[model samples]
Target chain A: MRFLHTADWHLGRLFHARSLIEDQAYILDQFVELVRTERPDAVLIAGDVYDRAVPPPEAVALLDDVLARIILDVGVPVVLIAGNHDSAQRLEFGARLMQSQGLHVAGCTSATPACVSLHDAHGEVRLYALPYAEPAVVRDALGAELPTHEAALCAQLDAIRASHPAGVRSVVVGHAFVVGGAVSESERPLSVGGSGAVAAQAFQGFDLVALGHLHRPQTLDGRVHYAGSLLKYSLSECGHDKSVSMIELGADGSVQITPMPLRPLRDLRIVEGALAELIAAAADDARRDDYVYARLTDTGALLDPMAKLRQAYPNALAVERTVLARGGVAGDAARRLREQSTGELFASFFREVADAELDDGQRGALEQVLAGMAAAQRESA
Target chain B: MRFLHTADWHLGRLFHARSLIEDQAYILDQFVELVRTERPDAVLIAGDVYDRAVPPPEAVALLDDVLARIILDVGVPVVLIAGNHDSAQRLEFGARLMQSQGLHVAGCTSATPACVSLHDAHGEVRLYALPYAEPAVVRDALGAELPTHEAALCAQLDAIRASHPAGVRSVVVGHAFVVGGAVSESERPLSVGGSGAVAAQAFQGFDLVALGHLHRPQTLDGRVHYAGSLLKYSLSECGHDKSVSMIELGADGSVQITPMPLRPLRDLRIVEGALAELIAAAADDARRDDYVYARLTDTGALLDPMAKLRQAYPNALAVERTVLARGGVAGDAARRLREQSTGELFASFFREVADAELDDGQRGALEQVLAGMAAAQRESA
Candidate 1:
């Protein structure tokens, strides 16, 4: 059974605070074109359909239109999930009604695993959907403490294993920060309060694991694979080849993943040099037509780095200045300063801006303000 | 020839800084219900299906679903337009393809009016869609120099009138701020730098002119009318009797309007008083049950009004100290403030904040910043 395997759509999301709706639509169009040509039996969208729990109206409408075009108009069946970024309740809305139309959206609280058993002339293959769920949620669902991203996923596998019994071919889908996976720079550090690591044995029972939430198309193991996002969402994910994993499940339950290149809408390219050199290089490089994320390191300041960059490349997504560390300092103080807790640095900045040596009374006032803000945060939470 | 007239749906909108998706859905549900029960031959949504040019994805999807249900499930025909908030290009996208499906979306630059004639067993009613256009656009469309929003609108009306040389019963649809009409605070102020008003005489010859843009449901000289937005978008419009003006056109060219209430999912009430009075009043009210916007007037101080209000009404959109015009002194100051240029005010504000007089260099800096911003605005224009 051949199907287009992809996940982490992250629709309605921004690329570093800028709206990426147009870029996303562009990538999705490629996928739709691919579907139109390949004619896969079903399209498997692993998870992260949206960037946030409460997606903007544009995001929602864009997703809806894309889904309508794919599932309803294009004559293709789709199976999707909710990732960590998704509000499972909101994403899974209309799931029950939409399911009848062969569009499966399995978010949280699946009573049993949503098994889409499709049969070709050869045999039946079961596609098991295990959307990203916290270990606590799994524990509540199964009435047991499956206390890890991997553990919760393993529990789902156990259930799927039991149902398959003697000899049924099943492929598992999930969104998780797996232990053995090579994560792209953009993937959020999954550890919550220092328990980020998870056991690899969690998916021991699965024939094949389709993973998401990591935007690097690769196999964690030979069987456990990631399809990755269609495009780079952040400059942190620079130089990663974006693609969809097309998986073919054989009659005997063997699975082979063939990576299909998602047509590159843009490239995240970083360049470091003096401002003049950088400007000259940018002007020379004609690839400015593509989306570019650039960083220019210059000792002396240019009049306006943005203005200079835009002179050559009008659509530069990002441009950051990197002033070398002063004296014996190793590197850019900006990056080092950013590494510090933003609040702490902000307070220090405020002190500098005020140009007042903080005495006991001033320090006490600053501490009081910080304490008040912290208290407010706690109250809101 | 009865039709449901509604406009400024703003499908994906944020009301009082909170998402109005659920409220929009609730109101739309009523519309769907009205369509089903009343069984109007045609539904005329004058314009502004979305709040912004790029609405949230969910908003787009919800609108599509709602429109679908009305057209397909409810068995009603629809006529629509693009409002000031809309991108004409985006709204008109795929409109040409959907014309035969009983859904008429008119967001084009055609000089000749495009009419959608709905014929039932009783008779035929023609709908003339004239999406919102400024004077320059109207002038360009008609190859003339139109001077006013009224003139621009009049050009469209002339076209619509020209469409029906046979003189069949017809209704003209437009999205413009008509002069001498009662508008709520939620409606955008169109003419900040120019005369933003569309003349009443623009729709002089039409049997019924279904208007959009202005959210307050009202008739212009009893013929041209706006159905109004589905729900209140701001606390300033708290007491607004928000409704859709249901129009029933007879066999002759006469029309009747019935104001159908759009019950919000919850009431958005703003109780203005002193802190103590507000707290006392909130105690009796279901503070947690509804969206609230409050302004508390106090003699001297308000110690974190947001914190206090949030303690009782958790979802308070905003809370401000309403220092209501102290014996008309505030009004005089306000008038004087308005008279001062932003640059002058900017310098004054900075001087007050710094508690010092501005130096020549400081004044130059402030002036430069304001001038730069102004230049950028001009460039954008």
Candidate 2:
């Protein structure tokens, strides 16, 4: 049995205040072509189908168009789940009706995760789809004491196992920050601390664990895989090679996974040089349309260097001054600033102004204030 | 052939800053009961399924539940369109997939309005659904000059008529402000000027014209009808007899219209008396939970009247002081204020302050200023 595994499409995402809908569309077109060529038995999209809970109209239309092509036109079944970035209710609209047409979506967390069965020459292979759910949601749904991500996942898996027959080949599709997985800047932290990470061994018995929520495609224990995002969503992901997983399962429940590389319409890249040299190099550069992040090393002031860069690389998204951070007193200060927490930064400012370090009482008060502000920010977020 | 006609549901609407979801749900339960009891051939919701372009999650869920009960449980086909308050693209999501299950939605304006064919022992009856569209949208869709509501409706009806076979009974479902229809404060104006109103003669050829937009259940020329809103949405709508229209079509295409009254969970009421008397009356009132707008006629100062009123009428939403307006100089001033437009009020204020009638130039300048402010406010709104 063969199936395509992909996740984190993040449709309607914006990069550097510019809409990436066209870029996403370009990549999705290629994905459709790949599905048509590969002819997988089914396609499994783990989660994060949208960038935010409320996607723009064009994004909704794009998803509609793409899904129609794959399901109705190509005659392939799809199984999708909602992520933290989606409104479960909205995504699940018309879900039950669409299921007959081969579009299966699991949006909300329930007592039992949505399971789809597929039959090949070897017999039935069950796919359990667990949508991204908060610990509180899981606790309420399952009537279990799930105070953390691992507990919630374990409770779900236990429920699935209780109902499962022995010796059945199964796959678990989910969205989480698994232990030992690589992280990127674009991924929203699942929680404030270590509780968000689920242990990799939680899926010890599953044939294949397909996951999302981290934007780098990598294998863990040769049984779990991340399909990564459709495109490089952040500058931190510049060096990452984005791809989807193609899973081939044998009659004996052995899995062989292959990474199918996707070519984005515009690649993300960073260029470092003096302003003059960078402008000169633009003359011979063939990929001027690629999204570029410029690091200016020139010490002297330049007249609108960003405007000049855009003359050649029109997609230049950001610029930063790195001359002071290269090698100087300012460089040491920058490094120290990067290393210090908010409380430490405040303590250093206090020492500079009062010529004294913060006492234990003052430190405790400051920490309380900082924690309150952080909680407030998180609530608003 | 008989069908139930309803419109202006305004799901997710807020009345006086309080969510009306529960009230809406209460009334919709009765509507579903009506469908079950009447068992019409089809259910037609003319338009205004939501109060705004983006409805709250609960509203979406409510619509989903109601539609599921009507279509999936009761086995009645529903034909719904989008009103001006809806985001056409968002509402149209999964529309095609839901069609086979007998949920027909016309969210976007096209060259040809959505047509659903129903049959009876006599013959076929075509229902043309024209969702709310701006003149610009109608112009683009039909490649015609639709400069006003009348032109747009005429163009759409023309398109429907050109292809409509002769001797076939037809019904038109649309969302627009027809001429001679009463206006209410709760209804958002379709346009800035008179162009928003369409002539009733535009539906002369159709057997029945089921319409929305004006939230009053009324009939015009015994042919065009409005199925009023589910509940009173504003203080000014307190006197509205909320109901749905039931149309009975004979074999010869003659129509019999009946207004099916709905009982709301709570009614909207206005109470006029001194604060003390109003409170005294509330003790005997059986419907204290009904939403109340209090008009206080007390001449003397009262402390925290709203708080005192809430003890008896917990759902009292607004309070107004009407003592001074009942008699004397203040009464005259209040009456004048009610009769004057903003420009007239400004002109009167200028006369009182400057002891002069404003010159033509000054009047023109003031008019421009008011126009600019109005336009700005509209844009922001």
Candidate 3:
């Protein structure tokens, strides 16, 4: 049985305050085409289907459209689990009813991992789905004393092992921060201050394991795989070679895994140079339409850097003065705060208050308030 | 064919500054029991399944649980639409696949209204579901010039009539603001500054019209009925007799409508009297545990009115001195703003910024800030 494995769509993600829904929509359209061309028997989305617990309306619509195409147009069975970023109940809303349509979603952790069995010419293959769950959730569900993520996951693996006897070809799907996997800024910490890693050996018994929560595609011991996110979700993930994993489980228990690259509509690129050189490079580059994050290395101030860059690269998202001249008051932190724009000041203050960076809407509101104050002062003058 | 008709659930509503999720859960549990006992052929939730377009996670879970019980446990078919408060695409997520399981959700305005047919002992009963949509949406869907709510609804009704031929015992379920119905503060205006009301006669052809978007259960002409909300969503709805409409549609196109009252876990009560008299009344009242909105008619200065009321009514949500002494600078609005408690100041400021009242979380944060400021001032002294 052949299946496509992918995860961490993060459909409503924002990169540098710009909405990525349209970009995601474009990429998913291509994914549907790929699925249609490959004609895989099933698709496995390990987890992190949405960027937030409550996704924006457009993201929900995009998911709806893509899933419809995959299930109806391509006629492929799709299995998915909820991730730490998802609201389990929301993702699992109509899961039971959807099973008939070949769409299976497991959102909450259970004592026994939810299993779906498929029959081929040789025999039967069982697929176990384990959604992201806290150690406390596992303890409560099983009435056990599992203290860490590894313990919780090991407990679940043991249950799966018990449910299915030996010699049954099985695959396990999970969303976890497996120990030794590379981390990225886009992926949220599974637990407080980064301590929610699970041992790779906990999932050793399964023929293959498809994992999520890390935005890089890599294999551990050649059996456990992280399918990774489809697009670059953050500037830090610009270096990630995002792709989907295609796996074929032979009737004889032999397995084959391959990575099929997905070309994004707009590549996420970070360029560093002097302002003038950056503009010249952008003009010469064919990917000027790509989402650009430019870090200017100029020692002196540049006039309207973002505006100037946008003339050459229309999709420039952010422009930062990375290098500063060694000076007296310019180096002072208090002076830096005062010299920043109203948007920057408000963004910094909001980060301190909310413990999260501000979205574009918040920045827009701050800009309006500052504009109004400036107008009032000008009128008084 | 008999069915329970309900609407305006506002499942994640906030009353004053408290979440109504628990109250909604309790009421929905009873509703599930009612469905089990009544054994209706089907259930119609007209609209407003959520209080906001993007609901909190708990509300999503509650709706999922209640719907699961009604559809899976009680084994009843459910037909629902999206109201103004809901994001149509979000609610319509798995609608097509859910149809096989007897769960029908119509959340977008299409060229034609979505119709579902059920077989009863008599014969075939047709039910049309029209989800809430703005005038622009209807215009875009049908490619017509429907500039008003009435025009858009009339167009949909015309389409339904055209498709169903004639002489069929049909029921139309919709979420709309029908003209001549009493308005309540809890019910959000369908359009800006009012003007979203469709004429009652626009729905004249249907044998029965189950409507939502109004918090009061009323009939425009006996054929069109507003099932009303499940509970009192606002202080203005304290006087409303909230209930669900139970309808029996005969094969002969005859209709019998009955209002079945729902008992809430905590009833909403509005109390008005002098501060001392109100407390005395609360002491005598049996429903002191109910959510109380007190309008104190005191003419003199009252210290800590909310705190004093809370002593008598533990669930006192709000306390307001409607009539203050008409003298001195104390009567000035600016002076009153300065003299109010930190909570009050924060609430007013939040209302101005968000265009809505602050919830309990915001109020608690304000109290903490005030306490910290007071402590710092004392330390400085």
B228-274, model 1: which lDDT tens digit per residue? 88877766567778887778777677888999886777777877888
Write the candidate numbers in order of decreasing TM-score: 2, 3, 1
lDDT of 1 at A365: 69
Tell me the lDDT of model 3 at A261: 94
- Tens digit of per-residue lDDT, candidate 2, span B1-381: 998999999999988899999999999999999999999999999888988876777888789889988988898999999987787778888777777789898988999788999999999999998999878789999998877878888989988999999999999989999889987778876764243898899888899998988888888888798887878887778889989988998888888999999999889999999998999999999999999999998888989999999999999998888876667887988787975667778888999999999998998788657656643443222
Off by over 4 Å in 1: A8-30, A48-173, A191-209, A221-223, A232-241, A262-381, B8-36, B41-119, B122-174, B200-207, B229-241, B251-253, B262-381
Is candidate 1 or 3 superior in TM-score?
Answer: 3
Q: Pick the candidate with the highest lDDT.
A: 2
Query: What's the residue-level lDDT of B34 in candidate 3?
Result: 93
Cα lDDT, model 1, residue A146:
72
Query: lDDT per model, in order?
Result: 0.73, 0.86, 0.84
Categorize the docking of model 2. Answer: medium
TM-scores for the candidates:
0.64, 0.89, 0.81
What does DockQ come to for candidate 3?
0.45
Worst-scoring 10-residue span by lDDT in model 3 chain B: B372-381
Query: In model 3, which regions exceed 4 Å deviation?
Result: A251-254, A271-285, A295-302, A319-381, B271-288, B294-312, B320-381
- Residue A121: error of model 1 in Å? 4.2
Which residue pairs collide in model 2, if any?
Answer: none
